[model samples]
Target chain A: MSKVSFSEEASVEVVTESFADTPDPRLKHILTSLVEHLHAFVKDIEPTEAEWEQAIGFLTATGHLCDDTRQEFVLLSDVLGVSMLVDAINNRKSVAATDTTVLGPFHMVESPPRDLGANISLDGNGEPCVFAGQVRSSDGTPLAGARVDVWQANGAGYYDVQQPDVQPERNLRGLFETDERGRFWLRTVVPRYYPIPDDGPVGRLLTATKRHPNRPAHIHVIAEAPGHASLTTHVFVEGSPYLDSDTVFGVKESLIRPVTNVDDPARAEHYGIANPFRLIEFDIILDPVRP
Target chain B: MSKVSFSEEASVEVVTESFADTPDPRLKHILTSLVEHLHAFVKDIEPTEAEWEQAIGFLTATGHLCDDTRQEFVLLSDVLGVSMLVDAINNRKSVAATDTTVLGPFHMVESPPRDLGANISLDGNGEPCVFAGQVRSSDGTPLAGARVDVWQANGAGYYDVQQPDVQPERNLRGLFETDERGRFWLRTVVPRYYPIPDDGPVGRLLTATKRHPNRPAHIHVIAEAPGHASLTTHVFVEGSPYLDSDTVFGVKESLIRPVTNVDDPARAEHYGIANPFRLIEFDIILDPVRP
Candidate 1:
């Protein structure tokens, strides 16, 4: 074989040059930058052949782990914090609107529509919690008819998809709308912090990195209204164990809502929940669409 | 929900800190650097959510495309010039050994051992060629009995594995050993340049990038002997169309051997071949094993 004599510098140059003719300028720029960074990573690591092979095998396993029901790559991105970084870059809130986070892989299923104050936890498990919130614009004006889609793990820290036999379909998931006053409430069990699926490659990566796979207990919410930019975020339970180190980096200090123990029988009856149940109030603020 | 403002800088810090306790220091360093580069890549691209999703889908599809026989991820690496970069970084020759290139996915099957001058091209399909080479140490001493494993695509630019039904099993692959003088020769058809298996996600990426997926015609070789470091490389055919722009960037000027068209009938008869034949001489130089 001939010796082409490739230095680390030359390798990067060749790769970036290859993408010069990419028809899409944005794609070309992205690809060129990607080559530069990726090559830099290789040079920095200087991985042996065995290590490179191991990486290939790990990536292959990650891909195989995904099916119609699971998305391992997204989980990979989330665990590595790339997903949150992208989200942060793309959704720069202007201080008036609520901050956004990852739309975790679980949002694949569309929430089942229900009336306000509906019980989403159909299995009747875990401590009853009444979640009440109002949808408002950044200006403090209530946004009537805003759609709110919510989903959360059961008290056992498992979603309906994870325990199809034990959990009923659509358990702890619902789609609700703001009333004339932009107030909406739902009856459900308090969500517990849960481990992200870790039996696969991403899970292996977490374990290998000495990092816990648990996410802070949180309820995903996607609120959208005409004339407002849609908001996709999570309302984390205050004091959750993994809040400070949520495996997916989805937690935001502003997104944390304290759960209060409600002893008032009148309020419990009004919200159609048992006395001594937990109550969490989270208000959603959406930014108006740019004119 | 409380408002926890997250800047791009904070996201990287959180991720790097999460891996601080990784038991393996190398892994910890690799993960940290990976996070830094990956997050930087996302920030540089600022890809739309749809673009991000598209990338995830492409990666998932690449994985799905791999089975026991195919490796789409490796192909992805190759087309992105990552595979070559890894090869280049890991195999930094000190001017005493043959240059290394990618051990492409097709080297799965073991080469059948044969005597010197044995014909590897069983179908007798393309222009016959005599591949002769000498294995020597960097100090110019003959390295007798060095094992040379060689494989190449047939005349139609397809490997036996690629067309199992059409090509005979192991049609163009052989394992040979140098004689006492460290010389080995073989009778085989001259290989033609071929496009990579680009029907998968990687191929789609190449198309989108306006890059060709054709590799220069080359014979894969692995030469090993006692007291010397093993060599994994390719003997590229000079003047091959994609020599200057190998889709995988595996081509090296030193590895390109000019093919000589010999019309001498006497020489063909001596080598037990047709009158008109091509010839290429690629001398292997092995680096001595470090004490």
Candidate 2:
């Protein structure tokens, strides 16, 4: 019975009052916040009717472009930095833990399980490199048997799903188990920086805003171990374009790993690769699960 | 070159800087404000990744529901009161002028022009009523030759478009010009308060919130004159269910007109209606166009 007519000054209150009977308290909270912020945005923008219509059209177009393979709304969220913000908010671990970034849209397929030193580049795409990482607890104790899931775009910046005919199935994807010393190493092509699938409404937004659509070159990782929190993040390749200006705003200063050329035959042989192998090494630390 | 890593504390600045190169200043201003407000909302909600995904899915479903005849997003806008706020901001006139409301979605077809006092209820749906109103300027001068466009839902709370097979085309819709004395009258059925298209995601949202989707019974109006700004509004039928709880927040106290049972034979004869008819009289005043 809390029926109150709408007014400009009481807009937020009125709209929020409509949601008073939500069964879920959390849903009520989120809807209330959304209405308040949404109304505030509309009031601040004071959009003309034409402008408002244009926005609805934009969103509808964005939705229309989304399907199983293409997620235009996710792209919209990514380009607007909401995806990264959500990542940041959800992965708020201690400083001792490795920093996190967005798990981009390319992880649609699970990485096939492979031996620790197996090469994942089925088609030998991009520049060959050794991607070796150590998983550990926040206390630096090696987390043996930790799961390391990896996926990335090929040299030309396209994932297997994006180029079904051109790229071999799971061209640059793998799942691995860390050894007793908590180390995992495998062969992969150095991911090249590329524009997100931007031929759609989100791309139009980037173009309209004079923004670039390219994300920095990066490797995707989702690590998990018993008694430790699961972490989904990326290891950025240093010096890649758009590292600082990733279209998805997924770059973390600590997550950027340098691609170093190692002359050590011992290191290369250990990874079962040729001498003087190009290497990108990163280590991950996961926070212990709280009680 | 405003490349900066995304962080919770710097999310707003980093995102706004990305749109700094937008050529259109208005777009830039709007995007800047939008990003600021949007990021603030995300931060406030601190949605889990799952919650964020749910929102994206909701929007995608809302988009998928949109077609030539269905605008689920507009319904979303209306239910959240954004439509009314936009109308309020755009139609900020002096109190002497008429209060404005949302132009509901049924005004798709052009209302056919009819002479004053014509019967718009071709189907004879609902309870027969006489609707009369005068178009005047803010200074109280009758505005002759004002083009008044009118449309409304029928008794069962459905428009002709919703029931094409049952109702005739252009049923209960009309366009008439104000006479020299600024008087206009029409024969129509009293509109019944009805639910919005509640079979979609927005309807589910209302159901989830325990909010009924019915709007107060009302007739849509768009009056335009030579030197006055055109207005899109509604004259709400008083005593109708949901008048105070119009789901779209389109109700204004001044815009509510009672459907009086007037027993004036002479007046009814002048209007060519029954002696004892249901008369809903509403007057509209437009604001002059700014120089």
Candidate 3:
């Protein structure tokens, strides 16, 4: 056999050339860049076969840890901050619009529709708080009838999905529509900072890296209306521990809302909640769809 | 609430800082580099949320496809040329030692010990071939009693593990010891080029990239001795269709060996094979252990 020697550099070239015929141009571009970056990483690491095998095992375990209710890969991306980085790059916000955040793994459950001012906290376990918000276009026009889907963990920092047996179905989850003034309101409890689902491969990774797995207390919102780009964002609580160190890096200054103490009885009665409740005013501003 | 805004660059810093307490310095370095590279990849791609979700799903399916007999992660690394690159970076060859290649996924079955010149092709199928080899140090000194573990697929391009019902146990696999002259020989069938296990996600990746999945015909060998670094490599068939385009980027010119047709009846009789058998001569050279 004639010698057909290939150096390490040559092998990379061969692999890149092999993808020249990819049918889709976007796929071709992505695959080409992926091959280059992947090979570059391998070269930089110079991992032994044993080390390489360990990576394979880690990734496989990460995959196995995912199911219908849990997504370890997304968590992996979250902890690595890849999810937030992608969000930042793809969802560049207009100066007047709300900033975007991670649509965390727990958003799979469809939120139950509720009337304005409905209390999503069915069990009434956490500290009383009222959330009022407005949905508007970038130009300040009210986006009446816009759909605002919301969900959050209870005071103990457990989503209904995480504690299905303990929490009532759809606890702290509601879908409300904006009224004539593009305003919406709901009664719920102040969300507590909580650790992400650990005990899986992602948890193991956190432990290995000496990093905590807590995300700051926040309510997830996905608001949408016709003729506007949909918005998926989190309204993080100010002063929550981990606010500066969110494991998923989902915090944005524009997304933080202060929890104010509302001591007036009449004002509380007007919203049908007790006096001295915690009040948070958050507003969603959506960008018009590009032509 | 005070604003705690994070830009794309700031998020990377936050993620990197989360690993501040990593106990192992090497792990800290690896984790830091990984985070940087991963974040860079995401920023470069700017994949939309849907594209990101598709990646998560693809990885999940890849992990689910792994089992005891099959390893989809390793296959994924192989198809991406990562395995070979890792092999190359860590196994730089001495000027005189044999070039190393991938220890493919199929080396799971242990080779049964056999005397020199034993026939490993017990099934009595395919074109007969005689394989002879020498084990030596890079300085050309004979390595007596060196263990040479050898294995290959059948002429049908299926490993015994891939076809347990048909192929006899231990067929096409043997462990031979080098004699005083540092020579070892075995009789087996010529291995045919075969497609990798592509019914899984890795295969789907290959299809999406517009690449073929065939590996060139080759015999795997792992030669080990107490005083030298172990060598794991392949003796690929020259003129194989996939020689220039092995899916795993495992081919190297120095590893290819011509299969010569030996028409001499006497030689065939000497080796206890039929006339016009195939003969391949391969040798193993190991590097001295570094002090």
Candidate 4:
């Protein structure tokens, strides 16, 4: 045994050997690298004991602030832009196709499917509009029998899922399959701009950061065909107040379009609409994914 | 209203004009900056859709894996070095002062305090050693009555808290006060090197990064003197295998010291120790804090 002194190292062993066998060479390699990098970072910026403890405490609170209906952490991610980062990396759009945006935290497991040309608006108080759209490949080839899942906030920018008691079960939300020429149309009220859910830690974060939580008024669409990459994009009303500054950063330049007020009684009659009704037309172009 | 199109900035007005009110400037600024930078990062990487989804899933899992006893996210922060960065910004050490390190995930509240010269090693099985040290101001002035909280691993390098069921509470942990000459001495067992806890997301991250999780043997020490900056640092054992490559990068060359062995029977009688024993003597110098 070597002599033990409180002098600079030369005699005593500074580190101990491994206590247990670590299986999985891959895991071992990954863990070792992580430890080395992590350690290096910590050494670079030495923190006080109190500050370190405070950070731990903050993390503990963030964990406790999570539950079934309230995912403050997810909202945090959404605001932080990690959600979009992941979406962008996973769903790179073709040059000719519409760009994808964040799938906000409001999507639930199931939405009611409806027939094409059917009206999804339960309350008839907002601006009456007919939404007509086509699903096509990037090369303009129509995709027959494509499915479109669509949902949007009411005139007040609240969705059925958000105001379950106020809105009917399927209000402003429907799934429709395209016809032979990849055409899908529906009659509904135009969506309105509204604030995001603000009753949790995410709200506190917004308050702390001094950011508005309002998302632009837009229709959420998820279009899919068997061989093509599924498209989840949004169509913002060209005159929506929050377009330039969507709270969740879920807007694109290509998807913004005018809602025209048509006065021709004959055209209105063909679509079973009263004269001077509002109209919105959108086209979705998807790209085929490589197998 | 103007006949709005995708190119028209009119959409911005419509979206925000109808909302309750515009967000405060600070939040708006932070959110906008964050969005810009985050978007830039995404564009730079341009990861595939699947990879983006996987990144989202990783974040989701990171949030889910957090709880009272464990915070994988904080560990993530520690490993990422962000925690240290924040800490460093908050705690800038004065010149000649001991540097701080990561607080680690362990470190429960209220380590049972003990009187000066008390033995913290309860196991009684490891190689017996004496630890004697002094607390002084940077200019070598003794700091009498300074509080010193110390703890270390056992002969096998496991904290009592790590082996709760086997080791007695408060084993190898103690609190002491400096004497008039700023001197402190205690009898204890030599601590050994050990691995950090590796059963959480931090562990998974380590595995993914190919890094080892071993830490060199060291004693934790927190010294507090009136009107001076308190220090939370470690007295690293010299010659330890992991000293040069601490998993957390906590080892500083100035802090490493050898634990010497003594075999003088007469001297052992004077200190009431066995003929063959170990001795470790060191000093901790601290910088004064104005506040």
Candidate number with greatest DockQ: 2
**What ranking of all candidate models by DockQ puts the best one first?**
2, 3, 1, 4
- Each candidate's fnat, listed in order, reads 0.70, 0.81, 0.73, 0.13
Query: In candidate 3 chain A, what residue range of length 10 has the lowest lDDT sum?
Result: A1-10
Q: What's model 1's TM-score?
A: 0.95
Task: Specify the highest-lDDT model's number.
Answer: 2
- Clash-forming residue pairs, model 1: A1-B255, A2-B254, A2-B255, A3-B254, A254-B2, A254-B3, A254-B4, A255-B2
Candidate 1 local lDDT, A1-291, one digit each (tens): 232335566887777778888989988998888888898888888888888889989889999999988899999999888888888888887798998999998876789999998999988877789999999999999999999999999889998988889999999999999999999999998899999898999988888887888998999899999999999999999888978778888888888999998799998887887787799999999999889
After TM-score superposition, the amount by which residue A211's alpha carbon in candidate 3 deviates from its true location, in angstroms, is: 0.9
**For residues A1-291, what per-residue lDDT tens digits would candidate 2 score against the true structure?**
246667788899999988989999999999999999999999999999999999999989988888999999999999888998999899889989999888878899988999999999998878999999899999999999999999999998889999999999988999999999999999998999999988999999899998989988999999999999999999999899888788888888888889999999888899999899899999999999998
Per-residue CA lDDT of model 3 for A1-291, tens digit only, reads: 233344577656767777888898877777777777788777777777778888899998998888899889999988888888888877787999999998898887899999998999987778889999899999999999999999999999999998888999999999999999999998999999999989988898789877888999999999999999988899999889988778888888778898999899987886788887889999999999998
Better of 2 and 4 by DockQ: 2
Worst 10 residues of 1 chain B by lDDT: B1-10
Where does model 2 exceed 4 Å of error?
A: A1-4, B1-3
- Expressed as tens digits, the lDDT of each residue in B209-272 for candidate 1 is 8899899899999999999988999999988788878888888787989899889998788667
Off by over 4 Å in 4: A1-63, A66-70, A85-96, A110-113, A121-128, A137-142, A160-171, A225-229, A263-276, A287-291, B1-44, B81-99, B123-126, B162-166, B239-241, B264-275
lDDT of 4 by residue, B1-291 (tens): 332321112323322232323356533443444344444444445556554545545655666677655567776665544444544455466667666654555566456666656677888847788787899998889999998888888988787776778889878878889889998877788778887666776677656555566778888888899988777778888878777556555666777789998889985664456778788777888888775
Tens digit per residue, CA lDDT, model 2, B87-201: 8888888888888888878889999999999999988879999999899999999999999999998988899999999999999999999999998899999999999999999
- Write down the TM-score of every candidate: 0.95, 0.97, 0.96, 0.77
Error of 3 at B250 (Å): 0.8
